[model samples]
Target: MLVKSLNVLILIVLLPFFVKAQTCGITNIALGKPVTVSAEQQYHVGADAVDGNVSSGWFAPGDNNYIYVDLGQSYNICKIKIIWQTDGRGKDYKAQVSTDATNWTDIFSRTNNNASTDSFTVNGTGRYVRILIATRVNNWASIEMSELEIYNSLAGNTRPSVSMTLPANNASFFSGANIKLTALANDPNGSISKVEFYQGLEKLGEVLQAPYTFTWANVQAGTYSLRAKAYDNQNADSLSLPVTIIVNPSTRWSLLGNQGTNPDSVFLGTTDNKRLVFKTNNAERMTILSDGFVGIGTSTKPNAETKFAVNGAVYAKKLKITQTGWADYVFNDDYRLPALSEVEKYIKSHKHLPGVPTTAEVEKNGTDVGEIQALLLKKIEELTLYIIEQNKKIEEQQRKISELENKEVNRN
Candidate 1:
């Protein structure tokens, strides 16, 4: 009976110390939270520290490495635990707490620590918790940690939910266009504080009230990932799934009038060596080649020798042809007109007039309208000359006849 009473008294005396040595059943508040680090290796990211997995870890070379986690809201921090990797451990380190993540207050610190794991009680209240490794054990240059557990002495709070509502995923836009970003945010147990819009990691703008919206103006051409972050009244934040968008170059002419344009710089053609096609009713009507050849109503390539080709007939009210020379030179005094007999002989041999194309030739190679018209005029002037000569001869014969008749009458 005496030994039992003594054992019970000793147990009562050490119960308070045992309770103080360990965490008071508080839940870890840093699990799966957003983690930031000063530097990290390629595969060992900062998120590994608060991911609740002790196999994978964050690795940063060089001493004075630091990492932090956002608890999503303010908490009465009660304890902290750090599990180090087998080969990497901190020689001197400290724990800090911050409400805004800018200013920090030291809660616990140790020097010349050689333990593989460290657990300690702390009295602080903050939404952000940080661990700074001042030096590595064994004078090493790298420090690695597997897990960092932070315990809070308060109940868990619901995080705000957010989602992007405008500019659907994989959307496209022209460069220099204003992109309107809209988000729908809700908090189950509290009111929303603000919603911030981001393009990748760049914050575009923020909205503090309902109907969260922001306009990002004059965005340049590129592929971008956009998201929204919503914060509740308790400062707990949640990120929306990213929306990807593409911004294409805008070097196009609009139907409306344009200003500040340079005629020499502006063009309506392809930059590459490809044909520019014009379509009407989903049918190709015309095409302009890279070499400046144009085809109308023709799918086949335009003839290389011609500048413009039309597959069908063309009608115009008036057509003009500019020629270097005309048939007026046919009336020159030095001109030697072909004899009628010689022209007849040539026509009989060739089955066509001199200096004119044959029927077969005209069918194979189209005629030049100006050249053919000039040849026709030259033939007309030559015929007129021939008629004049014949008339002169007839007049002479009639004069002679009249003179002879007069002489005969006188003799009678």
Candidate 2:
């Protein structure tokens, strides 16, 4: 009876260890490890199965295809998980382990697998783990797996650490700007193989060597979540904390200096329906309305009827005025030339010259310089015509007087 009781006590003492040996932790030892395959399709190489990304995987087309992973060294593998791609699962397969890779020993086998994902508690100790497929699900000729995770009951590889160094969190930039992304990555027990930069789920770029950097150019305007993922030489990877950034419209100009700017694309204006104001000495110097009217030396909105409004005088070396029509039409034959008597009557009654703006009109609505110049030219042309007519009359009178003199001399 004492022997029986001692045996029961001994079994209880080893119960916890046995339970621990049957289950494996979450760490996947097969990740980032070197892999080999009998045959692989494009973009579905054997390395994809251990890339730590379940979305990407390996695919081989034909019967009796197999893929194997090298864990770098042997481990006490306790769990094997296979996530099969839809419609591309292996119906008959075997999970095998090997020390020399040439001689393999099957730890688990399955026939007519209907599950898309399968996990098995395996008792194996080897440097390599392989999966051999004899037939595909639904009698398909291709076999594919999204992930093949091998968990070691013993200690395994450590994942690399990564952090973004450039473009600090919450940083802002202009659209179409070239942003340099940098990352600092290191492996605890191995060496870094590559660092990939991602904006959300989309990968921007990657660098294989040290001083990892990528230039993301011509990024559109939007809010983005950025991160860096570092993969070690063993294929184990870890992501840095996400960094959020803001990309504003490229129309914004810096008060400092700007480089690599296209003059045609640069603008100083408002994006919305608001007026843009310029100031000097804490006072408004210029204002531009949303409708394109400009004002100088004033704060109030410019006159809508006029394209430009100024409260102060303007100084320019030269000024130009464009007119749709000129007073040269005054010389047209169809134009009636008013008599001088009619012009005198108009000036006397209206207190201004004919076709000229009155003082009150000029003060209230302002004068158009082009219109005034045209009117003055028209008056000068009319005065020239009057002087020519008077000269002709005087010549006619002189001719008559000379004729009379000639007649008198002849008669005498």
Top model by lDDT, which number? 2
How does residue 71 of candidate 2 score in lDDT?
94
Clashes of each: 0, 2
In candidate 1, what are the lDDT values of residues 61-175, reduced to their tens digit? 9899999999999987889999998679888999999999999999999998878899998989899999988989876657899999998764445689999999999999876
Candidate 1: 10-residue stretch with minimal lDDT: 18-27
Kindly list the per-residue Cα lDDT of model 2 for residues 246-274, writing each as its tens digit: 98767656777555444567766668989
**Superposed model 1: Cα runs more than 4 Å off:** 1-250, 299-305, 408-412
Q: Global CA lDDT of candidate 2, please?
A: 0.87
The weakest ten consecutive residues by lDDT in model 2 span 17-26
